[model samples]
Target: MLKTVSGTGLDNLWDDAKASGMTESDKLLYRSNLLGSDKRVTNYGGGNTSAKVMETDPLTGAEVEVLWVKGSGGDIGTIDKSGFATLYMEKLEALKGLYRGPEHEDEMVGYLPHCTYDLNPRAASIDTPLHAYVPKKHVDHVHPDAIIAIAASTNSKELTQKIFGDEIGWLPWKKPGYELGLWLEDFCRKNPEAKGVVLESHGLFTWADDAKECYELTLDTINRAIAWFEEQTEGVAPFGGAAHPTLPEAERRRVAAALMPAIRGMISEDSHKVGHFDDQDAVLDFVGATDMPRLAALGTSCPDHFLRTKIRPLVVDFDPANPDIDGTLDRLRGMIEDYRADYAAYYERCKHDDSPAMRDPNAVVYLVPGVGMITFAKDKATARISGEFYVNAINVMRGSDAVSEYQGLPEQEAFDIEYWLLEEAKLQRMPKPKSLAGRIAIVTGGAGGIGMATAERYLSEGACAVLADIDAEALGKAKEALVQRYGRDMVRSVEMNVTSEEAVAAAYADMAVEFGGVDIVVSNAGIASSAKVEDTTLELWNKNMSILSTGYFLVAREAFRVLKAQGIGGSMVFVASKNGLAASPGASAYCTAKASEIHLARCLALEGAPEGIRVNVVNPDAVLRGSKIWTGEWLDQRAATYGTDKEGLEEMYRDRSLLKRSVLPEDIAEACYFFAADTSAKSTGNILNVDAGNVQAFTR
Candidate 1:
């Protein structure tokens, strides 16, 4: 229940760090603060931190640089420059290819050279590969108690959806190291604009050009997550009742010593242990009375802590005669087996490959009936942090009834992540796609109108365009135009009736095979009808609804399906007329259909937001120059109805807006580009007006 620390002193710290110069002491202090922040967020040794330094190379006797990351076995808060394991970036990327091969997991086991000093004695963090993957100057990864408390709950995905929208990407839990690095590498390539990433059941990561920005973003991200959780649950409540009466200091020491070895084995670290407990009398009484199994199950919030603490711990009831040592050990081992079996089943259902799983569980908490709780870590600092995360999660769950029931990615998906060939290929092959390159974009009704304009804009922005239209010939001509500008390989023409579900599904299946997946969809296939309310036939109304309302849903649904399958962030844009906001004479069918599209955008925006798929609507006024709806006959009929000459009628429509001008198709195209780019990363369900300042009678 502890909120994030304030940012009041952060700017001052940045300035001080910048002005003080990089003295040995200053560097050590900065590293300490970085590590401390990470541990506070995640469990003991459950997170990683790194700093980049520019030092001359000893081998070549030239000015070569290297990244010095946190070495294995060192606590973040206590580590010095000597504690870092340095690696050349070129060498690290080279390792990706060797590590990705199926046999490399088992074959590549020898220690790789890190830095010049203590090369044989120290090892790098397991997350080194990921740190290498990012091009940022600095990186920090942590499993904040507040975030994990939320991520561990069954409602995590839904709650995250409601909170961060489609901007934040969520990946199912996977063991850290090479495989996890590859998964993240692929994600970063796909979402080049993302601020950070949340690893479900794992932790969070934030990186930037500088250390200060990275740190502040981390705090802000976690605080936003906490705020979202609070908003959903109304408020957070305190955890279980008070602690049990205290025990002798010697007895506590003895218990901690017994647990230390197991923790050391998990983390492969040799360190000291420390213990603390709630002083509340109520908490003491409750812990003393609660069931041993329930209390122990609440151990560490994430799995990486396993290296610092074992899977489960011993619970002693303070028996004198029958100390129950053998029984307690047997029970603890049994629970570990149960946890492993459950974990294995989850992996089987979620993993896509046959990679070996981690040998240890993240952490364990021992409940000593009346002697209070005993927590263990590879280091005292880690143990303390782990205890805090567990206690906070326990409280939140008890208060929210938000028990941890993970919904892992399906087996194939997990396999894809654990043994991602695509990510490995990216490191070795051609340069990564320009931020938006190779991304498939579908624009409905993309033939000689607003749709064509948006398609052209997407091409200029580097996305491969797939233009769809009911008119096969027009779609073909539009494809030729796009190909002339962006080359034939970057554009495709598809004839589709968006109103037909079968047609939409078939097109998407073909498009998925052709483009790998669809990343951006502009649902702009709409028809306008001009008829008086009394003269509007039922058939005409249904036809308008079919193409405008039903057509939009079909395209969006299919787009979401494809994006979710690809496990990538996607964007969708719905085109609604200004008349949808205000009634117009002789256009009931068109107005109602457009209004439906607007409402549909809001609903889909909320539903798709969690999956990193953004949905937005653009309301455009009359722009009929290139449209069939603005034919000479149509204009003459409208002019007669309005009792004005054709020129006067056009002037009236243009003058109705505050800008006193007509909105071009290019104007709407620009709005679509904004919604499609990184600039609108946090926007969804927003109604952007492309109208020349026309006031609506009623606003949503």
Candidate 2:
């Protein structure tokens, strides 16, 4: 049977979250408790809560500040201050102006680059803007069990109307982020006095002038709906009291970790914020009993909760002595494949656009005979919530049907919600391309390490790339490597200097003709000139900028023209250096050129917003393999200049960053691919620090 907490306990959490004396962490925990009070309330990292703090502007002497939102992948229950991503209200509002409608989202996001690099690379929640849109000091978004149950029902609209009345506005489920924010903005503006908004097939959103009010409102609203549900089905009894065997704790954790990534991808977030739950008694009882398959088929309480607890649970027969673990695993894999096939078929039937499909299942519940229940989430909070909801839903469903049976939103409806304009807006805002198939891309300095690695990365991801370098022999070698891997038809070789516009233009035109048109460009060519500011000369300055800055401009201009003419948006990646932000004693020109490239990316992002072209820069530090920059001789020389051994120099660099390690070419390539792929479609104008952790000069 589903468990219910006292109304007073839920109310207390609201008061606690609103109290001023509590630390930020305490407030977050308090908010989480309030959000998690009901079984249908929240699952793992499926929900978020925020409190806005007003601070005095040091410059203006007026109270103006930022909204400290839950960082990307943060679970509402356990998130602390460190889990919150701060955004200047003004800047967030400014982002709103970038897109006028759904069509322009790709262009707008392409122009507004990621502002800083100090925070985690995991993106801020798509609902960041929505929380900001709420005029209240506190805001929350959750995949409440009751709410999802209500939404998924065929009579959802009618039931919601009967329960919440006209005060609750409804928006069709849309992808999160800018698109959802825009929709919510419009909804709020139109409704003017709505208490909350419920997204069909999605979840719930509530806000209040204070944290307490928001929490209380959420509780009251959900409870009222529950009351109505009880009235409608008064005779229904809780089901499934049969027990199942349990698994070892260590084994369970291992399986759970392996399962999280798939779940996280399903929910469109990282698994780091997921909560975990493992109760051997519950698992054993649930899985060991008869009709385990029937119990596992009920859908999640909410769509967001899918990541923590997959659409269905897994029932395993436990036998420690004659353990058929391998056989069991194989069966599980087969089941997963069946689930995916079904999901794909549903998507095909419901999809409106050509958006790529998601292959990961959101959550998985484990049922071991004689064991309690074991639930996995990216974090502890998520896991706990999943367990709570699972226990409740199983009880409810089993009672209703003798065997638990639940229905999901129609495949078409689910697909529509999953691919809603608002959600797509968030996705579109990513600073990458939607598809690189049949697109032409050029990699400057392509004969060298980072450049060659990036070129290969692009090829692997399905783009026809041309490798250009000043050295014909090296270009040929690089071309051979790529051709050997992807075939000659996919790669081209050219000898050119990035600094020369004629060379850049000719290469771009030739490649465009060969591949039909240019769509992606990576400005990865440049030389490092190390000299102190006092020892730097105009010649040194000009030499560095000529290749790094001017080369990028030439390539960008050519790409812009092609993309504009094609009337399709494209992406440009400029490879900058960690020195662009941090200071090093004897590298004036290198630093200056890299910094210039960063600014150039910003300017290009803004300029290309209207043309459906996006420009961004990747600042990488200590990239080792396939780069001339991290060569042993090069490191030795740099180490000598710093009056230290090569090992010492490496250590110094590594120790400077939070994640103390050398950045790999593949790492930069991954970041580059992120910008170049459809995943970052809405993002433009952002600068990604592919460095392991070095530059810590600014905070935003």
Candidate 3:
């Protein structure tokens, strides 16, 4: 059975039945997972866990003590066995002799490889010494919000004494390194009765000889803090009471949709960015707080928080009583420029002699009063995670401010961690970003084969996609599959009828708020009709033109609006048909509509050239595999026109091609990818024929 003190406390999740059969190492992993499951215990990737276990030496076949800790850049919440770095306990103990005191503590990380036990390829983290030097066999270092709240308070040391007395100790702030590990070891030596220690402005460190005890101790420590805060601050107003009123849910979303695209445009001059909007209760309370600007300027107290969210967030001047989105838009660029200037100044003041050059100075987190928070990054996950870290910071601020004066880390200390040599080296080791890493694309008729395939290709190349379709059921399925494959942050689905002007505009707004802005637009929604000129009714002709011609225009117009708002050049891939270039018998209405799409691309290409927005067309013929269009009456109509049955239509089209190869949905998808990517940056207003070498459809 799980144990809990009250409604507000964390439930003790350890199951002895589950841990009974596991090895000591596996038990350590199980404990880490349980502790990481709640943000109240630790935020994502913000903590490390370790255990000392006996292992067989590969060479001597003799048992030896080994230290197993979470590797560099590993998240305890999702980490597996392979994510742990194995180091010899004796070798780690030997590192103390080479350590030349605090000034040169960074050099200790260089010697960690020498401590590798069993030749484990996983790199050890800087926190390894902190965990290894602890006297106990099991240890955890986590940035739990409840504990950090006390750690970040101005009276943190006294607060710690009041809360837990001698049971839990406190230490002055020290950058995590070999020296900090020694500091922990020394503190333990002096206070043999202490359960753990809170590192000022950093996080909590707890240990026990047994993995289960350590895990339980961590939970108990955090729960005690939670209960104390709840009891003491029962009637206190959070963030000194809200100074601004929160807008209705729909209004908040509307404001976010409007502001995101403009802000995305100004900041994306360096590289395209994805955006995440958060309107959680904590964020709303903080953003509306009277002290928000002051607290935000002071920045986050924890290094892990600021590392992802930047030193501080930019507060947007948005008021719910007088929501002036247009006025805000006019001032957005200047606001961003001022932020960049402030960041540059911060760098100049705090940079060390060997500091890396200034990075993208634009703020990662944006705070809007009466609205919510918005975050942008090179990818969707980073953007969302950055928002999460900011939320954690907000939680810390709420608790500390209510009970005691909250304090952010000193500016110089924050900069030192932000531009640390070790951190810089770790960043340099990351793989280069993908070609479409930050690009956002909107695919019309996204549930269809061609649209789905194109979205997949872009997603695989690191682009976030918004799939728009009239088919709600099919759209949901497509979104689900894509989300499963690419992660939830990278895919969104909006029910949109491209033929409706309002629907198209709403879809673009949804995309803008979901991502930062649009960089690529695939106008692939279409219809097929087969009738001789004499037999074709006006209704059929209008239907084809409404979906194929006007729908392209609506989607493109909205894309251009957002693309221009962002001030970034974008790609427009219009999926026309081979019939547009080479007319087919018995399909006058479809041919005319597709032909209109071809000409529309040329016209838009001319208008968009000055803006660096490339417009092109991909003309695909007989894409039968997985094509919804081919599965309908058009298949029978085309087969009858060729004097064959449905099964023979694909063969007839394939054999008719000069290359005699069937054009799959994937084939058209490749063409769309080319036009959307930088590989064709130099070419625009051109048509590519993907019909297995169709001579008739060939472009001159």
Candidate 4:
């Protein structure tokens, strides 16, 4: 059943605005927020809303009816009045008279900018004319999952008629433009009593004189359709009662450990774009279902999905516990190639002049019971959104199948829409980005301090930052905090002890499942130790080595393994110290462990070079500002070594350096980003010193 939003907070929006003369748009924005906030009504960036406002301009003293519709490049849920582009409705309606149809969407779009009332106008959504053509004061269009379930089914026309009867109209598939708007205008003029219309293989549209009424109509109509469908298949069992078991959380992590890397290695090779992965219970259940092979063969239920999930998702037929990780990956590679071949064939079948060349064939990959679901894309948000759409699509089809057979748009219809000019324009609305826009990054010990700083840097450049740390509590807080800046789907936090191979492996696998794979590994997890070489106990040496040396080995080696599998060259940055290059008395354990990791990194660099992976080291010294590494006991030791307090030691180290400057964590992060990005494309097996001009630590 569709749940309607409460009017409890509606007064709050009008409270302060009433004294300031609130316009009709203030109410429309409130209604749009009601629809936008619910995923059941509209997935991310997949819906549009509008209000036809007749307002008198203060300057011109002229009353004009204008359409304020959702603009390009904004999500309706969090949108405000500014997100709605104001267009002259009469001028927009006149566009219907000039329509020749079909391929003229390009020319139709040109008039939109001219119709805007603002000196600097935002681009209205492609569906602008449809809202203007409707004879109602308010219009709401949403790709509700249930609506799509009914609309995308083979019996869409019949089901649509059954649910709404004479009150709803049905419009055949026509790309959104002046022609479609004119056709809709004629249909609504004929069916004046209809509350809404079902767009064949697209979405739903409801209209009314009131914004609230339009929203309520959409919910009520869609819910009734859902109810009728559910009623038809009363007492039905999902998947014929077959079991689609999921692995235990621990086991799933272990599988992701090996699988994410191999998949990453297989698909990418020295590319600027990064791959990300996502898995959930629904995704796992869908992929692990007994009839997934057949169920997944049906194409996307809606066209917007094509922009993210591609035509069809790939299914992996291996177990997570497969003894031969390499062999299983090799077989998976063959399956991927086969999927590509099939995709190419499908594209050729629908080939036309405007047809886009085949996209990367690995948009969505279904894993077996042990591995769960894996969704991939060029960026983190896209990967997760694509996964959400696939999961929703799978469930929608399942529901549609329970009573009636499931069906999507015909091959030709989907292709025409996918390659169509208006739809393609919607995707290009976002501004350009850096090369790191699609890259996946991981910062060990990332819950706070340097790790968090590094993670923030990656996110600023549009990379997905996975904060891997041993502290589960801190990790959760970090994820929550980062979400406010980069969005909820852009940041991920995984708890893993970097020294434990099982944990490290599972972390990567989970990363693979959550994001497609890893491209940049910042080996920054470590602890400090200070003792006279003769007085250094076995415990002291072990603790330092476990975190500083062994941790680096596991994090880097596992990352390399995945990179090798991806066949995409990547970057490995070990955060060593200046103490590793120059002897620091009484810091035997910390110095030796750091040295070992630096040497190990060079070895990795030498080995990883052949596959396009570049391994490097960033040796930063005297970085006490906001660093957990130099706190408490470590701080005491450094101060003791200098025969002074913490502040005095920092000052001594700063002055010892040629530049007389204190190094910060961000300074080191900058160096790490440089190596990971394409800026240092030709460099490898090198150590860059970021120690405020430490001559001894400088690389020749």
Candidate 5:
């Protein structure tokens, strides 16, 4: 029986009781999840798992073999049964007759749908043939770093023989497709006694007649490789003994914060990009190494790593001995331009007659010594994942360099895989990006009802948000809810008192590091009061002004500075109130401060117009539901001043509006969304009344 201890090197998680009632397909999923759960086994979405199981044919009452394989673009770690593409095993075998040669292999992907079993809609991956042709009941193809390190070494085949002997074989490099599938089949036929084979500069492939055996063999193969590398390279200095020292954690983060936004701006000419910062020990070791530049320039060997991280990463010009941020920033634009030119040249040299058009030429991964690794992508998750893949590449390089000379995939081969027509089709099939896609937002008072709603709305539309609020407890709850709905990649939180200039500036700096830079700013931190002119104390008057009026200024001022630094014109939405435009009786302090917010936005709009920054205002009235202010003394004071109970106040406000409709937090959120979105790009310096038709507050 295999031990089932956690954190003790890939524990076999299969249980007899758990597997007792599971079908073959269920066992396959269980096995795949276990293997995928560990990065030591496979990187995310860098593997394929398959099982050939007998199933009753839908049309005929006879049993037929069905090949269930993980679908294209699905991660093994998170895949469900639906994520598997089921194809008829007999039909998949028949595709061998249609294959003309290696030149027409991509066309085989189109034929996979015709072999679908039981009308499964999940699209079969390009690797379907690799699994189908392997003559085994179950197969696992994983790009474990431990295995790839051996595969990417200069003496890969000899090392494979030395490490696993006859149990595992090695195949020469070939791009994955129908032709490579045939190679795998032929190799297996000649080496029937072998449990697996390592594809040169690719990954590991292990198979067995039983699902559990196949899973265990894969684990055993990887574990052997891991143990071999540890023994062979024990105490050997990695990457030439790390040429530079890593900066202190705090200093590293501060450097990342300074550099990320500037790099984001330079690369965002085509479209805005989000960023991810990784300063893991592995990354630090690689970026600070003497061999980092040489290995990075050679690029990644595995197709999975190459595809996600691009051909190579850009090494920033920063010396850890003498940190010069300004000098780095000054040279940044030239470095980026040179990368683009080199990429365009690569595309020109490698383009086939039918290759897809060159993609965004900017490097996905950026390495800064002493700082960390920064990755910019179309979204936060992609940015972070790109960083993770590069780290995997770093590990592979470390092992291979210590043992034998590390070798990346030849440039033409890497380009062919990157620009493959099948891969291009998959990219083209992706759904259109949302309106606010790639944009980053910072919402003040983000723990409150309207603020949370606005953050959710932004996140739903594909914008990453930094939730800022003075109340840490409420901020935590708000972040948890948003992270649950939109994912942690899209939501970040910071405790901020908008009244303090230092806090506001620090929040923006944090935002810059967390998500590149800000594209939208929602100034919604507020307070409410209903004191008469005679009853209003100096303290009460100043409190209202400090929060409502001064807070908006501080937040907007910081936003302007960051936006200017990014050189990407941004949007600022101030959540003022109906009292800003229409005077309210017995609310002298509150109304005055609200009025100040409106004029400030107007002035900002004028100053920001030349720089393409737009300033707008959202006026919400009597938003009682879920409002933090409404749950406290303000609700009672407003109810008493209006001669109605708290419950009756909402109804009274609703009846008083021209539309006679009550406004909720969502209603205000929608108006804020409009100003933040490009829909209001031409309509800045505008006040959008979300008060359900209050004529007194109408902008017209």
Candidate 6:
């Protein structure tokens, strides 16, 4: 039943191909989308598609045959022509004659760029040559969980014969390179009737002259594997189960909500690195199975999975009722160390003198029974992507074991693929991530307005954004909104009263658990108050000072403590106000507290400079839209002071500024980003005004 996504109907597939105004690259995009749409076929960036098309070269203005293959930047489902890595097929083929063996492997990288007919910035996929070697005009190479389920099993040879018979050729594990191309080239010559080549412990390479047939070959092969799995496992429990039973869904989430942050803390090696906990059904089922420890030890679903997931998942046991967090966390730390030691031993066993230095011996995933599995990496982006890839692996391994024993590739084979030059080329093609890519940042009062904007900016620039506020309801709503846009991994929410030292400590501890450490802290939480000095009551004055002045001090103190503990220098931005630089009448409480907060930033900056922590302040005024302080009675009161209605006052305030523009939360966010990112590496003890050019509050 597995098939292409609903697009380009089969009956008209050739009709459209024959009578299409769409460019070849556009047609390939359409086909790639169809292939990538089904998660069963390819999830995330797991596949490559290509078309042999003739195009006028931009450089030489001559028509040339190029293989336009989907490269980096997206999964098959969402790729555009821009995702296609256009290469001259003739030039790509010319290098095939020069290959003697695997020695020319690394040199393939140097040759790819020169062979690229178009100077597209995106590098060709590591499997470019595999596409080039085949005689077909179109190719669909994807890792369908169903196909991998068969190919990754101990009985792979038997299953391969059962499913495809003489129609599909089989190759033992070979890392994608010049070597793989040679193997495929020779096999195609001998097995001319084959529809595809099943790469053992790898994936599928299916091709046809037409795009539709190539896609059908991939789907049809996977369907055959699925059919075999269905017929063989008629009465068998999904996989060997003791771990199959699960805690109540609610209880499981409760355990994850508590345990994941702690696990994240235990495994994190640096302030920039973080953890992502995934409790999807497949992950939970696999981790909860009784024989999970033994089954998981088999290894990654494939060699390429090792690039992100490492060789094997680290398994742990947990009691949902007595999740003895602190003790359990300590145990996790020891387990991670053991995992590292074991990896080093494995490296010692297989390592050659010329091998690249082993990647850090750390667990990318932890299979916990009650809490599901948690994936760790340097940043939220990597953590989530790795998380998805691991989920696919879990399904493949489970299906493989159900069919036969799960026989993973040897550890040395994984090492070869892990250190292959093509993966190095992929790494080389990766653009430098943003300065805050790995930093964990928290914005206090980030439920809405300037704080929320600042949190969003941090997430976009690759920092983990934790929204901290005193309002739990608001925090929950904000978390939902962010997760809808950025995913659950990059954003977190915690409720805290910044003025209460106990609350502040608890908040900081929560941060420690979630991200191992905190690097950038935005002290944005504050309460706005307006009254003449004589008219303000003692309680009102205390309240304003507690939130604006004392709150800033507490958050800054905790940030310093957390950063010092981690031994990683960080950045802190205090969201002061224009009133801090110039006082306003009938607003003594708000003005004075803000003034104190600015000075607090300067003092912190002076203290933090020696340790490389930068502290800066942004004076944001009249950012009335989306602000909790600017609504209802407060809005009426502020507008009354200007003798105008709310809308009139907004315009009046905007018109009065030197630039005659209203300050927005995003404007303040831009300044906060400057301080939070390394853009201000040399800047500290600084103040940037975000009040639309208010000269009266300008500071030298």
Per-candidate Cα lDDT values, in order, are 0.62, 0.64, 0.91, 0.76, 0.91, 0.79
Q: Can you give the TM-score per candidate against the true fold?
A: 0.43, 0.45, 0.98, 0.90, 0.98, 0.80
> Cα deviation of 174 in candidate 6 (Å)?
1.6
Per-residue lDDT tens digits for candidate 6, residues 416-463, read: 777664565566667887777778898999897988999998888888
TM-score for predicted model 3 compared with the true structure: 0.98
Global CA lDDT of candidate 1, please? 0.62
Model 3 spans > 4 angstroms off: 1-7
Alpha-carbon RMSD of each model: 25.5, 20.2, 1.8, 3.9, 2.1, 5.6
Report, for all candidates in order, the number of backbone clashes. 19, 65, 1, 20, 0, 4
Q: Tens-digit lDDT track for model 2 on 291-399? A: 5666466554345544335556655444433545555544554555565676666566666666655644433465544434545443233356567667645543433
Q: Judged by lDDT relative to the true structure, which candidate is superior, 2 or 6?
A: 6
Q: Write one digit per residue (lDDT tens) for candidate 3, span 1-700.
A: 1121222888888999999999999998999888777777777888999999999999999999999999999988888999999999999998888888899999989999999998899999999999898899999999988899999999999999999999999999988888889999999999999989999999999999999999999989988999999988898888888899999988999999999988888888878889999998888989999889888998999999999999999999888889999998888888898999999999999998899999999999999999999999999999998998999899899899889999999999999999999999999999999999999999998999999999999999999999998989999999999999999989999999999999998888888888978999999988788888998999999999999999999999988888888888999999999999999999999998999999999999998999999999999999998788888888888888889999898999999999999999899999999999999999899999998988888787
Q: Please, what are the lDDT tens digits per residue for candidate 1 over residues 1-700?
A: 2223421222223455462667432453474455454333554445667655565566676654466677765656556666677776666666765664533553332324633322434566566776767666677777665566556566776655666666566776665666777777788888878766777756777777666666667767776766555555454222333334444544543433333332222222222222333323323443554333454454433554432333334454453223444455435545445655755564466544544543333334545554445564322334455555545444333423433343322334444443344333333455543445545688998995898999988888667788889998878888898888887656777889998888898677555433435678999997777788898899999999999999998999888776665445678999888887888888889899999999999999999988888999898887766665566555775777678886787687788788899888899999999898878989999888877887773364
Q: Which stretches of candidate 6 lie over 4 Å from their true place?
A: 1-24, 54-65, 72-74, 118-122, 243-245, 257-259, 262-271, 320-322, 447-449, 467-519, 532-585, 588-700
- Indicate which candidate wins on TM-score: 3
Off by over 4 Å in 5: 1-8
lDDT of 6 at 356: 69
Runs in model 1 lying further than 4 Å from the true structure: 1-20, 23-32, 35-39, 52-54, 61-65, 100-103, 106-111, 114-121, 230-295, 298-301, 314-364, 369-371, 375-700
| Tens-digit lDDT string for candidate 4 (492-516) | 8889998799999878777776666
Distance from true location, Cα of 692 in model 3, Å: 0.9
Report residue 409 deviation for candidate 6 (angstroms).
1.6
Ranking by TM-score: 3, 5, 4, 6, 2, 1
